[model samples]
Each structure stands twice: as structure tokens, then as C-alpha cells.
Target: MGLVGRVREGTRPPESLLLTAPGERAYVDRWDCDVAAGIGLAHLIEAFFTSKAFRAERLALAAIGRGGTDGEALLLAMGAAQNFAAWTQVERRENEILLEDFAGRTRCWLAVTPSADFTTLSFGTAIMARHGMHAAARSENLAFRALVPFHRPYARALLMSAAHKAVRLRQRAVSGG
Candidate 1:
């Protein structure tokens, strides 16, 4: 079983919209915005993965690794694409989608939930950091900790960007455009 699979087997909320304890430090950040009525869980996931905002974020991270020795390499090693399939699908319901990915000393969970009115979408992420195996790993965790404060707004913008895309796609689908 993968890291995510193991997490799924543990004692945690099956459909938790945030990350839980069991690590050295943890953070749970969420962003909520209005979405179209036709937007579903699947649509949200697809939109998020394919959105320009996501691509931009990935590029920015890659840029951070452009020049440097160990630090650059470590930052560059963080691949946005790897997380998509690496995350184990913990829950999938009519209005919610939950996925968890645990790689190295970091365990993260992402949840997307649509409000009862189908007009509000909430995107949440829970990240747990642990001790690493080597100096590079330790440095990486330290960097992550240092950047935590900036994460909330970045996460919110990313989710909102995807939500907008999902709404557009839904409108297109409904209008046969």
C-alpha cells in the first residue's frame, strides 16, 4: 500500500475537509467561493488540475529550483504532477471529493465540497510535516515551514481560479457551446 493508502486505513475522518494530527507540525487551509450549480466533484478535480493557476504555481516552484546547489535540487524535486495520482482517493460522494498523499515526511490531504445550494465550493488542504531522512530533507521541511504563512492566500487564489474554470465549463456544457 502507498502512503496515502496507509493513512486511509488509520483513524481519521473519512471525509475530513482538512488534514489531521500525527506529525511534527500541521496546517489546514481552506478557500470557499461560489460555483455554478452544474459543477460537481469530478468537475472540480478536473478543473483544479488543468487550470492555468495550477500551472503557474508549478512553474513558480520550478523556478525556485532554477539556481542553487542542494536547495535548488530539493525544491525542483517537488513535482506537482506526482501528487495527482499519488494521492489515494479517500472519499467520493455526490458533493465531496477527498484525496490524501503521504510522501517522505509530508502527509497531505485535499478536500473539495460543494454547498447544499450547489453554488458554493469549498477547497481545503491539510499538510503534516515530519522529520526527514537527511540534511536535504530537513532543509526542505524548514523551507516549507518558513513558507507556511504565504500558503493560505496562494491556496485560496488557486482554488478560486479553478472554481471559475469549472463554472465556465459547466456553462459551456449546459449551453452546448
Candidate 2:
């Protein structure tokens, strides 16, 4: 994967709650990075939730009455939180966590797998769209189609920004700041 990850033709794991149904679709993108200070899932998650791209999205969600995060972000940064203002922890392990929004329309899976010397971080998202009674609109709805251009770029930006922030954070920590 590149700095922000790779667009791969893959499906979520069988244990994932964001499974694809008969008329639903799933998208998986992965980002892999190796940091000198060794970034873990918690650190990466904190960097993500506090990144510029994510803050903008969080603000927009808050404007729509669907988000909040001052305290939750703090908790997440300290690796002590599971439920944020916009999403709840659907599943978790020592190095991975799956989160789903309250509406259950989107699911995010983040994993940090450690190799011998480098740690790889992967991020994925699954979105489910359902259309009204229609014969051919089973794959995607109008909104989903319209959102494709914007969503793809936003996803990349979000991952990129977060990964960069994690690197910065590691550097600062290493510098004794």
C-alpha cells in the first residue's frame, strides 16, 4: 500500500458486521505504513480522529446533530475510549477495531499488524446503500452513485492526513517533546 493505502478488490472478513447482502455492496481500501517509533492501532486511531480531515468531517457531522468529540477524542487519544460521538466500537482486538455509525450505514475497520521489524496499519470502510422498490437499482442508489467521486477522494484524504499525523506524532514523541 502507498502512504494512504491501496484500493483493492476485497471484501470484509466473515466476522465483520458490514457484510454485503444480496442487494448491497462493500468497498475495502487498505493503507500500510511502517513508522520508526512503531505506531499501534490506538495511536493511529487518535491521529485519525484528531486529524484535519477528520475534524472537518466531525464538525460537519456536529452541525447536523450527529457528532461531538472534545472528551471522546481525549479518551481515544489515551487509548481508553470505544464509543466516539459519531460511531461505536462494533468489534475490537488488541491491534484492531471496527466501528460503525449510529445509523449503521457505514462501517470502518482498522487493523495494525506487527511484523518482525515494521508495523503495518490498514484502514477500510464499508458502505451499504439500498434503493427503493426498483428492478435495476439494486446495486447502488442515486445518492451512492452521486457520492462516488467525492467519497473516494475524501477517503483517501482522510487516510493520508491521519497517517501523516501519526508519523508526526511519533517524531515528536521521539524528540522528547
Candidate 3:
């Protein structure tokens, strides 16, 4: 009655609902959105991809309640941790966690302290780029930008596999593919 799909409404009520206690059905109803959201992601992914890594990362993040910004952060984190920063660490200052990356050789330091979840990753990625590793720095950016929006049923699976493959393929192509 409130808003159709926004609130589950139907003409015929369940016969068992009359027998069950008020709190008993609450658990089931609570999970309804989760189950539906899960199925939606799967359906969307399958209908969208030609590969797997793209699917996996997207699904993993979605399952964890993360989206585009998180996706971007993830890419940046990977680049910074693996390529740009020779060392990365978190520091507590007042009430915040500051993520710091050091370029090691040049003694250049890049720091981004996010008050929110994915900011550290994005910050780290910027650090990596600032240090001059363009390839590693931009991989996640490319994935998030080019491949992460399929929204098909097999989305997660296809995204993971496809992302891995795409990276490899891109590497090969760049090296002379």
C-alpha cells in the first residue's frame, strides 16, 4: 500500500502469517531485501560481461555494500600498495586514521587520510601516480571506468575473470600484443 515494490504488498496474505508471531516473520522479511539484491546483482552481471575479473571485484564490493567510490578506492589502494609506495602505513592523529605512502628512493611522501572507507585506497593510488608508475597506477582506474558497470546476472564471476584476463591481455598488448 505504501509504494508497491518499495513495500511488499499483495492482495492475498499468507495463511501461515496469521499463525506466526509478530517477531517471527521479522527475520524473514529482513532478509528479503538482501536476497533480492543478491539476485539482482547476479542477473545484471550475467547479462553484461564478456569476462570475469570485472565481475568478481564488482560483486565482492557490492556484497560488502560498496559501489563506485569504493571501486575507485580499491583500484588506488592496489596500485599504491603494490607499485608506488615502497612503504605504506596508517597513523592515528586526533580522531582520524592517516594513510601514508613513501616513494622510498626519492624520499617523497604522499598521504591521504580519508574520514570515510575508500579514501585511503584512492589516496594511495594518487601516491603511486605521483611517484611515476603510470601503468600500475592506472590499472584500477581503467577497470573501474571501462569494465565495472555491466550489471548482469553472472556479473560478479564474469567481472573477476574478465578483469584478470583483461589486465593480462592489456599487458601483452602493450608489450607487443
Candidate 4:
């Protein structure tokens, strides 16, 4: 039951997916967990969206809009307003789901690969500064640059928390609790 989170370097979105610019700065944070049983990619995606962690993240974003403190609030506000349903599905495969925002500046992928004993579920997100006059993107980049020192660990922790929530939900479902 070990769940790990890491900052993936030089990870880019699929070439077929035209979202980020060639020279734009992008960051990828991934969380991996081993599930007791194989879970379909669609099920995993549904679990992720329905997880308490996801709900909390949305609420936090709303709170930021209503004046929450700290760097997270500032970063979220500078990025994009919260709209989970607004994220469009770009691709869906047997073990993966790739989603992008309507404007195509942000992307996320959730996948589940079954192994001999357990299934590995991974969630990754990539955010890039949009082209043209994007004040919000610029501000987000500035804040991200300024917060580089704390970004890796902070992102890891956030992903890990979400992964834990998913695991708990799966457990409860299996136990019929």
C-alpha cells in the first residue's frame, strides 16, 4: 500500500495533442499507487473526480476567490478559475484518460496499469502558459518561478494526499462500508 509522488522532469504532453507551445515552461507532477485489484481507467477517473480530495481542492479554489490566504490561493487565482466540469476529455484509452481545458492551456492524465499482484494507478498534470496576451498565465508563471523552491515537495504532498483519498475510497467500496 505504498503511494508515491514525484516531480517528473521534461515530461511533455502527447504530440498529437496541441496544447502547449514549443518553448513554453511546463511542470508535471505525478502520483502512483498500487491498488489491490485492477480498476478500469474509467472507474479510476470517476473515483478521482468523486474523491474527497478533489472536492476539497475545488472548495479551496472557491475559498481563494472569496479571499483565502497563503501562496496556494494566489497561485490558484493567477492560474484559472475552478471548473472541474469544464475540463474536456481529449483522449480515452483502455488504461488512460487525457483531459484538457477548453482553452487548452492545462492538461491532466489518469491511468491504471494492471500488474501481476496489483494495479498501478497514476495521475499527472501539466500546466503551460498560454500564447498571446495572457495576464493570468504570466502571473501564474511568475508565482511559479518565485515558488520554485517549494514547488516540488508541495506538489508531491498534494498529489499524495489525493492518491490517499482515492485509495481510501476504493477500500471502502471493496468493503461495502
TM-scores, each model vs. reference: 0.61, 0.75, 0.18, 0.59
Candidate 3 runs further than 4 Å off: 1-57, 67-78, 81-164, 171-177
lDDT of 1 by residue, 6-108 (tens): 0111224434534433344455555666654556655566666556767764465447542123222222222222234335445444566555653534333
User: Which portions of model 2 show Cα errors greater than 4 Å?
Assistant: 1-26, 77-79, 129-140
Give all candidate RMSDs, comma-separated: 10.8, 4.3, 21.2, 7.9
| Model 2, span 1-177: residue lDDT tens | 333344233344665443422226544444444544477777788788888889888988888887767667658656688788778887777787778788776777776667776566566777756556885555455666677678767876777677778778777787999
Q: What is the clash count for each candidate, in the order shown?
A: 0, 1, 34, 0
Best by TM-score: 2
| Candidate 3 lDDT tens digits, 35-143 | 1111121122222222344445446545755423433433333343222112233432221222322422111112222232211100001111122358864564455
Give residue 177's error in model 1 in angstroms.
3.2
Alpha-carbon deviation at 82 in model 4, angstroms:
17
lDDT of 4 by residue, 135-172 (tens): 87677777756765665565455445545555665677
Candidates 2 and 3, the one with greater lDDT? 2
Worst 10 residues of 2 by lDDT: 1-10
Candidate order by TM-score, highest to lowest? 2, 1, 4, 3
2 versus 4: better TM-score goes to: 2
Q: Over all chains combined, what TM-score does candidate 2 have?
A: 0.75
* Cα misplacement distance, residue 32 of candidate 2 (Å): 3.6
For each candidate, the alpha-carbon lDDT, in order, equals 0.53, 0.67, 0.27, 0.55
Pairs that collide in candidate 1 are none
Judged by whole-model lDDT over C-alpha atoms, candidate 3 comes out at 0.27
